[model samples]
Target: MSENIIDTGKLVEEQSDYLLSFAMSKLQDLELAKDLVQDTFVSAITKLDSFENRSNIRTWLTSILNRKIIDHWRKAETRYTDPVSSFFDQEGKARHWLVEKKNSTSVETVVDQITREEATMELYNCIEKLPPKWRGVIASKYLEEKVSDDICKEMEITPSNLWVIIHRAKLLLRDCLGKAEFQ
Candidate 1:
């Protein structure tokens, strides 16, 4: 048991950086990648007794890391998009009018009314109001700047699903922004 613990500790220490780098490549955020890697190791360590020896230890650890990365994506993706309230609302037409109205507002009035901090907080609150699925896709693709392929892989979605999610998310965001501006 002592030897097993030592081996596991040594393995984690040796592989943590590589695991973290891999996760970072997938996640594009240093802090979240680090957390995912750390969580992976912790989970692996806790489940060490279940090691069935059917596969290489490194493979087992990597599988755990992959799952961690996916979970992180799932959680992070939900923050950037909103749920589709009405799919047939003709977002493009509505958006053009909204932009016109917003732009017609005096620049000084806009600036005076919303400080940077307030704008950011309001934006965050709007994001929080989005439906869980739309939020995830938007967060992963737009906010995190992840490629579609990467986002799809992380979210286990197809290209069609990705496009649909993005379209709905954009509509939701536009609605949210419109509400914020009017408020």
Candidate 2:
């Protein structure tokens, strides 16, 4: 194979150590870092033919390893099973059941959907009434699912400021939502 062409044998020799160290730094778990690096290599192999060598091998491998690390953390953050599953069960025992769940007819379903839509619209209207700064914070933190650090950087606010803003925002939202019930 040409030096410019990717050789599967050399990919590990050239990049595994650097990729492992990078993963270890990001993930902070030696075993997990090693596993993710292995996964990175497997992914590289699967996508081998796509390599145009536009970037260097280490960069390419590092990108794959980075994605693996992110996916690991993202998966870690999510629930193993559906969270609502804890409230409803068919097995050994449960405190109660939704007596009306099975008997709801199509008209009731349509009404429920309309009610949900109206509630959502009302909440959006309430959110819009908040100050622009609080809107950004609430949207980024709750709606966009961004971390506090990113939100702080984007909003150019300190961590404490972010906390205070979110606290006040929630309080205002509660007040607004409460008022919405009357109107």
TM-scores of the candidates are 0.43, 0.40
Model 1 scores a TM of 0.43
lDDT of 2: 0.75
Give a tens-digit lDDT track for model 2, residues 48-147. 7666767656657767887887888778867475556656666746536456355656787887876765456456657777999999999998889999
Q: How far is candidate 1 from the true structure (C-alpha RMSD, Å)?
A: 20.2
lDDT of 1 by residue, 30-142 (tens): 98888878888888778777776766565577678878877766776677644443222555333444555665878887676556534554455566567887778778876
Best by TM-score: 1
- Which stretches of candidate 2 lie above 4 Å from their native place? 1-5, 80-183
Identify the leading candidate in terms of lDDT.
2
Residue-level error in angstroms, candidate 1, position 109: 44
Off by over 4 Å in 1: 1-6, 83-183
**lDDT of all predictions:** 0.70, 0.75
